[model samples]
Each structure stands twice: as structure tokens, then as C-alpha cells.
Target: MDVIVIGGGIVGVATAYQLRAAGHRVCVVERHATVAQGATYGHGGIVLPTPLDAWFGPTFLGSRRGIVYRPGLNSSARRFAKQIAPLQAPDAFRAQWQRLRPLVELSRDAIASIEAGFHLEFEQREGVLHVTRDPREWEQAQSALELLGEFEMLHNVLSAAECAEVERSVPADPAFAGGVMFPQERTANCPLFTKLVKQVLDEQGGVQFLFGRAVESIRLENQRAAVELAPAESERKSTREVDVVSCDAIVVAAGAGSKPLLERLGLSLPFHPIRMLSLTSPIAYEECTPHLTVVDSVRRVSMTRMNQRIRVAGAAVLQPEREFAKPLSESLLEAGTALLAQSTHDWIPGAAKISAAHAWEGMRLLSPDGLPVVGNALHPRLFVNVGHGPAGWGLACGSAKVVSDLISGTPPSVPPDTLAALRVERFAS
Candidate 1:
């Protein structure tokens, strides 16, 4: 089958790679001049291998610290609230986890397969510490601990002193109430991994990347999926001609920019836009720098080590309709940056030169239930793989594989329940 993937971020690239591997002709259309120029570029590199990470599981949407909502009345906000309400119940959460864990494991294996095949290095590092600050914070994590044990994932609950032994930079502050160390989980450079994947795909000879082209519309052409493309917004306005490209199927993986395209086809999804920020700082003191990534559960921040530098990222600011279309607000920017900086200072003080940090902010579209939408939607030939939220890197590979299998009419490697959990129809009223 021939497939046109509408997006060139990590998810789209991964999908294209999967389709190509399955002996399908694949093309990726990206609005930017290059890939990973959107949410992929701004993503935190941490990949949660297990369901215990803050970004995964049912408790994710319930965390006030992770999702900071600006005051406003909007349909999307209401819908988001409605969708997450049921997830707060213990039974509902476990059921969702049953559907989520398989995909998480599949994606982890997919990453390993890709790494082995290409031998690409993307600043990969192993292990991650999910740290809690106080007794209350630690107590709130009991559910996650229970889930980890039930799943039999490799983990160790560490004392504050033991955390220091594992990561020399972390001081034994009294506020530190220890952490759950996922020895098998790791972090990697997300943009670097994406670009490397694209390069590898190009070399393999079955995939094509059409950059600097904006998709103007989607319509049926001769019983097949087709997209009209014009020069991207960044391009010169002199080029007015639109190019029509048709394929057997179309997979929309355009991240926050997907709403308008899908809406044009009469499919309205609850895509709550959340502003996320990431900062990269040079290491100030090598001895003080953390050897692995550290997630501050209270602050909802992730401080990861990528070689000589540290990448600190977090902030899930829910935007109202009025603010969603505009640039990130100044107050929001200051607050998010302050939180990240404070978390970095708290966990590994003086380990990074925060004053000279490079930062990025991107709007991330999160599905109400916190799982990504990935399957056939309204039209038979149209598909979607968006709303992975901040865990895009962690789930991208598996989501791509699932969508590719669906397009090819192949039985998915995962169970029917896993596929059902991510289906776009799951949102249907």
C-alpha cells in the first residue's frame, strides 16, 4: 500500500519507517524545511519504559502540579474535564493501564530494534529517578508503586542517602523523601533521534520526505486519500499553485496543528492544547551533575543528563480558547521557567549553568484521557496518531507501528484491547 503521512516529527517519521519496513511506499509531508521543528524539537528526552513514570498511567490527568489551567470557559476544557473524571476512580485507572502497558512495552522494544538496526547514537542514557519531596508527596505515589510491583517491573525505592549514592550530585536535603528508581528506563536526545531516524529512512530507499510544503486541504480523489499542498507559510508568497498528492491512505500526525485539518473532515476531537517548555543548560560542575535523569514529582519537572549538558523540561499549562491561538503568555512563561529552574536547583544544585540556558516552548495537544488517538477515524482511508502529550517520545514508535499495521490490513502485534484503547472512535459519544 502507498501511504502519505502528514507530519515529519518523531511520530510521523517513525510511522513512515514502519510502513516502509512492511514493503509499503511511504511519503512524509512536513510544513517546515526540516523535520523535528515542532513539538519534536521542544520535547523532553526522557522515555518512560515502564508505566510508573509520571507521564503514564491513569493518575496523570488528575495531577494538579502537572496540568496548570488558566481560568476560562471553553468547550474543549469542559470536554477534557469530563473525559478525565472517570479516570480518577481506581478500577477505571487499572483498566486503562491494562490497555496502556502493552503499547508502552512494544514501543520500548521498537526503540531497541531501531537502535540495533541503525547503530545510531542519540545521546542515550540509562536509568531515571522519580523523586518525591515530602512525606505527602511520597504517600501520593503509593498507587504507582503498587502498579509497578503488580507489573513486575525492575524498580528500587531508594532512601535519600541511597539516592545520593546513585546520583552523587543530589544532596540529602530534608525535604527529599527518597524516590523510585527505574533502572531500566532511560533518556535520549529526542530531536537527534528523530533526525537520525529520518536519515536512516532516507538511506533505506523506500520513504520520501516532502518538506517546505503546507497541506491546504484533504479530499477524496478517485476513491483514495489525497492532500492539496501549497508552499509553506514560511515560503515566498509568489508560489500560488497547489500540488495534489493522492495515496492509498493518509495518517495525520501533525501534533497541535491537526485540529483544523481533522475538523475540515467533520471530525471534532477533544484536543486540549497545553503549553510545554524545555531548557538545556551546560554543566557547571561535572562532579555535581546527575549521572541519570531525575523527575521531580512535586514540581512536575524532568532534569535529564545528555552528555556534558543537562536538559530540564516540564509545564503543562492548559490554555483557554482565547489564549490557545496566541503566543505563550509572559506570566505563564515566567512561572514555567521558574518551576523548571527551581527543580533543577533543588535536585542538583550548581550542576548546571541555568543563567545561560537555551529554552524552547511548544503547544502540545493532549487528549482528555491522556492516551494518544491512533487509528482510523471518520473516513476509511483517513487515520490519526496525535495527542501523545508530553510522552510522545515514549509512545511514538509503538503508535506508529499500530497505525502502519492498520493501514496495511495486517494483524497488530499488540492485542485487540490495546488497539481499542487508542482508537479515535473510543471518543465517540
Candidate 2:
């Protein structure tokens, strides 16, 4: 089989690697010079199934309220609601979650497989700390724990002492009623892990990476497809005809870029661009430093250990992509620091951490229904594997395998009903 993967992000890279390993001659067309230069470069690096209830499940109503009322506190909820609004209504995150949970689960399993395959080490530290200053939020977490049922597959509800023990940097604040520790989940070095996998893909026998090639257009013709490529490196411009490079199938792994292709095909996507932010500070071992991953419920800020450095990221905007919001992230960090001030004295102090901090803008390809599209497109010889939203890193592995199967006409590892929900046809009239 000859397959062309259209995107250089993790999802596309993973798909090319998988397809190549599966005996297909694969070529990747990336608009960027390097993999993960896009959205894959930012935060949310938890190789997770971390309390899936927050991102998906019954606890979302309050979560949504928490977002709109105090956007800083629960940024994801605000982002989720914002992204899901055009698809349904502003108050539609519950119904959206009903559509999203399965997709998140798929990402979880896929990421686990990827971790096992490459031994990709991305600053992986397990046991995230879910800290809350509000006692009521703690109670909410405890109740939501019951509602989660079997979905609490990898989490352990822990006492405050246990959380502090796992992360010595955390202060022993009594305001912290308790914590739900996702002991099995780990934070990753997103760039390092992505590059490692991409390196392997490049070394793979049948895979060819056309890096620095921005695809300008794609057209279906004579039962196949054609892609226009412009060199990203050469100052001299030239158009190359991909006619000589035939493909049995085309996988649209182009992240948010997949939107225009769908539109060009007269296909509509439940897809939107939701911006998420991350700020990284130097590796400070002060008593105020947060070492393990910690979640501040009200502020919607997430702190995770990224190698020698620590990153506090998690501000989602269900709005248009914006310029660097350094002030916003810094303020969120301050709020996070204040929340942590009560719980643990260990973390880089706010003033000390600012100079070393940098902000990034990244957008997730979101489906209106909160599910990923993972099947053939309305155009023949074309398929989709985009709109993964926040779970792209984790979902990359399973999604690639599923996309490979769809392209190869092979049976899937999961049930067909599961696959049906992800197909673009679901959005068709």
C-alpha cells in the first residue's frame, strides 16, 4: 500500500510510522520544517486517562459553570463550553461530554501503546496532585468520584498527607481537604518524545518524510489524489508535481489545517480551534516550587514537572487564536501560586519564576461533537484522522492504528460502533 500522511504533528507522524511498519510505503507532507512545531509543541503533556471525569463525564455541568463564572479557575471547562457552543448551545457541555468521553478513552489507550513501543521518555513523572483550596470543591471531587464508577480506572483518591508525600514541594496546607492522585499517569517532554518518534519514523524502511513542504492544494482525480507542494527551505520557489508519487490512500492528519480540506471537499466538520496556553519556568527547587503535576480547581491552572524545569499550564480559550498572552499566563501562575501558598511552601516564587517564563499559542482541532474524525472522507481516496482536541498526544497511537486500518481495509481493534461515531459521515446530512 502507498499512503500519504498530510501533517507533521504527532498524529500524522505516528500514522506514517504505523503505516510504514505495517508494510505500506509511506510519505509525509508537512508544512513545517520539523515535527511538533505546531500544536503538538505545547502543554497538556500528561500521557493521561487522568481522572477522565474532568475532561469527560457527569461532573462537567459544574465544571462548565466554573469556567464561565471564573474562566481563569477552570479554563478547560470554559474552553470546552466555548468550543461546543456553536455545535450546540453554551450550556451544552454535558451532551458534548457524552460525545467526547469515548474519544478521550481512545486517546488514552493509543498513548499507552505508543509509550510501550518507543520507550519515549518525555520527562515522565507519574502521580499527579489534584489540589483544591476550596473544601466544597474537595467535596465535589469526592462525590464525582462515585459518579465516575469504573472510569476511575487509574486514579487513587488520596489524603492530603499522601499528596504531600508524593510531592515534597507541595505545602501541607489544611485548607487542602484531600486529593485525588492519578498515580499511573505521567507528565511527558512533548518535544523530546515527538522528535524521538519522528526519528524512528524517518529511519523506518518504507517511510519518506518530505519535510519543509507546505501543501497548497489537494485534488481528487482519476480515482486517486494530487497534492501541490512548495519548498519550505529553498529560497528559490518551485512547484513539484506529486503525480510520480502515487498513493493508494490519503490520510488527512493535518490538525486544524484539516478544516479547509473538508470545506474544499464540500464537507463540514464539527471542528473548531480552541487555544490552550503553557508557561515554563526554570527548575527552581524553592519551597514554593510545585514538582509533581498539581491541579488548582478554582483557577483552572495545572502545574507539572517538566524535567529539571517546572511548567504551570492550562488556560483554554474557546476563542479565536490570539497573540502571546504572557500577562494572562503570568496572572494565572500568580493565582496558582496563591492557591499553592496555603497548601505547600515549595515552588519557585512568583517573582523569581517570571524572567524564565515563556508563553506559546497552540490550537487543538476540535469536532463540534467533541469526538475525533477517524474514517474515510466524502472524497474518494481521502480519509481523516483529525479533530482530536486536547487528547492528541495520547490519542496519537490508537488513532494512527485506526487510520491505518481504515486506509488498508483491515479490521479494527475496537468495535465498529466506536468507529462509526468517529467517521466524518456522522456530520453528513
Candidate 3:
């Protein structure tokens, strides 16, 4: 089979890799000069299957800090707020979690397989500690902890002293309370992983990458998918032509960009681009650097160590469309770094000194129901493997395998009901 995957982010690259490995001819068309230049670039890098709670859950909505809505400040703020209202219900949250947990477990297996089979190296580490400074926040986390237990996930509920003992880099702050630690959770460098996989895919053959070329449009013609490409460096001359690539199957894994492309094909995906920020800086003190991922639920911030660098990420601003040039506000960055400081106050000094150049702001593509839309769409040959939200890195490999299996006419590793839950037709009502 000849397959063309649009977008060169982690999800696209992973899908292309899986398709090529399944003995199909694959090509990945990316708007960027290199892969993983989008949301996968500077993510939190934590692969936590146990923490399967969606952002729209009661905890996040109750906190009122996970999402910030500035109606007059943005054109789409009001509509975006309305779109997310349905997901705020307790039943909606539980349903999304039920659909997410299996995918997450499958993702864990996929990651393990990739590492063992390919000997992949991406500074991978194990363990993630989700802590809270406020006692009320800690109490709220009990439901999530109970869910993890129900899933038979390997985790431990720790007191403040226990948390400090487990992660010495965490400060023994008096405000700190008990938290949950998923011992099997892992972290890796997302960009590094994407680049390494792309390298392996190139070496393995049967795959091509069209970098610096944007997918302008996609349509069905002659019972096949036609993909129109615009050169990364376009000219105003009328003589220039739009390049069209025809394929037997097309997988739309373009993250936030997927909605627009699907819209051209007459499919309306309820996707919102939530903007978030992350700051990466070299660890000032080796001993002070956390050996595992540390998540402050109250602050809605996460800090993870990537070799010598520590990445602090949080602050979600929901937007109706993707914003590429919008920079991170100083207040948000300051708050993020301050949270990092509070998380490591007793252990690290001067932790809030990250330079502006090291900060990154990217949009995470989220579905209305808080679950990704995968599998075939309205068009027969057009498939989708996007809307993983902040869990892209964690869920990339599993989603890739599922899409590839569907394309190859083979049985998916996940259950049939799981695939049905992710199908594009679910929104057809």
C-alpha cells in the first residue's frame, strides 16, 4: 500500500514509521524543515499512563487555574469556553477516562517495545511524582489515586516526608502534603525520540520524508486521496504550480492543523488548540535537580529533568485556532518558574532564573470529549490519528500502531470498542 502521512510531528512520524514497518510505501510531508518542530518540540516529556485523568476533569475545573479564559482578549475565547462546557460534567470526565486508560496502557507497552526492539536512546527515565502543596488539593487527588488503584497500576501514596524521601530534590516545605507516585511512569526527550525514530525509519527503507513542504489541501479523486503541497518557500509568481501527491491512503496526524485539513474534506472535528508554555534551563546544581518527574497539581505545573536540563511546563490558554507567533506572557513564565521554585524551594536556590530565549509556547490539540479521534473519517481512504492533547508523546506509539493496523487490514492491538470510541464518525450525530 502507498500511504502519505501529513504532518511530521511525533504522531505523524510514528504513524509513518509503523506503516513503513508494515511493508507499506510511506512518505511524510511536513511544513517544517525538520520533524517534531511542533508541539512535540518542548513538551513535559512525561509518559504517565497512571495519570489518565483528562484536563476537563473536576479537579482541573475546580482549580480554575488549569484553564484561563480571557474573553475580550481573544476572538475565540467565548466560543472555546462553550465548546469545553460539555466535558465539565462528572459523567463526561469518567467516560473519557474509561476510553483513555486502555490507550495509555497500550502506550506503555508500545514504548517498551520500541526501546527493546530498536535499542532507542532518548535519555529515558522512570518514575513520576504528582505532589500538591495544598491539603485540599491533596484530598481532591484521592479520587484519581483510587482510579489508578482500580486500574491495577503500580503506584504509592506518600506523605510529605515520604515524598521528600522518594525525591530528595523536592523541598520539605511545610505546606506540602501527601501525594501519589507512579513508579512505573517514565520520561524521555520527545524531540530526540522523534528524530531517532525518523533516522531509523530512513535507514530501514520504504519511507520518504518531504520536509519544508506544507500540505495545502486534501481531497478525494479517482477513489484515491489527493494531497496538494505548497513549497515551504513559496513565490508570488503565477507560473508556480501546486504539487499534488496521490496515495492509496492518507493519515492526518497534523495535531492542531488536522482540523483545517479535515474541514476541507467536509469533516468537522471538534478540536480546540490550547496554548501552553514550557521553559528549559540547565540545572544549576546536579544534586538539586530532580531525578524523576515532579508534578504540582495545585499549581498545575510539571517539572522534569532531561539529562542536565530541567523543563518546567504549565499554563493552558484555550484558543479556537492555532497561534504560531504568539509569545509566552511574562507573567505566565514568572508564575511557572515560581511554581518550580516552590516545588524545590528547600532543595534548589535561584531556580527561577530561566532565560526568555529558553521558553517555548505551543498549542495542544484537544478534542471536545477529551479523547483523540482516530480511524477512518467520512472519506474512505482518509484516516486520522490526532487530538492526543498533552498526551501526544505518551500516546503516540500506541495510536500509530492502531492506525497502521487499520490501514493494513490487520487486527488492532487494542480492543474493537476502543477503536470505535476513537472513530471519526462518532461526531456524526
Give the alpha-carbon lDDT of every model.
Answer: 0.82, 0.64, 0.76
lDDT per residue (tens digit) for residues 130-219 in model 2: 666557766655544553454445666667777777766655655367666776667777777778887876665688888777776676
For candidate 3, the per-residue lDDT at 391 reads 75
Task: For each of the candidates, give the backbone clash count.
Answer: 0, 19, 0
- TM-scores of all predicted structures: 0.95, 0.81, 0.91
- In model 2, the Cα lDDT at residue 43 comes to 57
Clash number for candidate 1? 0
* Candidate 1 wrong stretches, greater than 4 Å: 54-61, 73-79, 232-236
Please write out the lDDT profile of model 1 over residues 1-429, one tens digit for every residue. 888999999889989989998899998999998999999997778875455553544335556676566646555665566667676566666677778888888899899999999898999888888788778767766777787888888899999889888888788865578888888788999999999999998888989899988898998655788999986675557777788999989999999888889999899887777788888899998888888888887667889888878899887776665578888878888878887898888898989898999988987787767689999988888999998888888788999989888888899878988888888888889
Question: Could you give candidate 3's per-residue lDDT for residues 1-429 as a string of tens digits?
Answer: 999999899999989988987899999999898999989997878764454335655566457555554455555655656666665555565666777777777777877877788999898888888877778776766666666777677888888889889988777766477778888778789899999989998888899999888888987765687798874575525545788899999999998888888888788877777776777877776767787788767656677877767887766665435343466566655665554455444333344345432867777777766678878887779889999987788788889989999999999888777888888888877
Decoy 3 TM-score against native: 0.91
Which candidate, 1 or 3, would have the higher TM-score against the true structure? Answer: 1
- Least lDDT summed over 10 consecutive residues: which range in candidate 3? 348-357
Ranking by lDDT: 1, 3, 2
TM-score of candidate 1 versus the correct structure, residues matched by position: 0.95
Q: If candidate 2 were superposed on the true structure by all CA atoms, what would the RMSD be?
A: 5.2
Q: Is candidate 1 or candidate 3 better by lDDT?
A: 1
